[model samples]
Target: MNLAFIQNMGGGGIVTILLFSLAYFILWVYCLVDALRSNFKDPNMKLIWVIILLFAHGLGPITYLILGKNSKTTN
Candidate 1:
């Protein structure tokens, strides 16, 4: 609420922020690797999706997870 109250929390806020940032970075990296590893019938489509995911950051990754091609084999 107040600046003094925030200051009283000392390094706790900084630690929390650092932890969240690290987690985000890890998730971003995981998404990148997953994008690379995915198998799509169209290589260009796969590349486009990877580019979207890499450039759009959080939103792109969520979209890829929700709407990108699935790699399951079809009979």
Candidate 2:
């Protein structure tokens, strides 16, 4: 484990980046699980959301949180 990179990041930079990265990962996983568990109007939507989350990285989960969440149908 090379911590030299962290030291070079300068004054809490690595910490800030790590926090944001962790937050993003959690959000992405939550969105991914919700997409898998929830029912959507279109049966194919779950697959689409999953694909987007896996490939689109940052923007994918954010978009799904904003838009895809509302698109789920109540059972």
In the order shown, the candidates' Cα RMSDs to the true structure are: 4.5, 2.6
Candidate 2 segments whose C-alpha is farther than 4 A from its true place = 1-7
Tens-place lDDT per residue, model 1, 28-57, is 777778778777766686788778977897
lDDT of 2 at 54: 97
Model 1 lDDT on a 0 to 1 scale: 0.74
Candidate 2 local Cα displacement, residue 44, angstroms: 0.4
lDDT score at residue 11, model 1, on the 0-100 scale: 94
Q: Write the per-residue lDDT of candidate 2 for residues 1-75, one digit (tens) a residue.
A: 778887778968977998989988899899999999999999899999999999999699989989997788977
TM-score of 1: 0.67
**Once model 2 is optimally superposed onto the true structure by TM-score, how far is the C-alpha of residue 63 displaced, in angstroms?**
0.6
Residue 21 in model 2: lDDT: 90
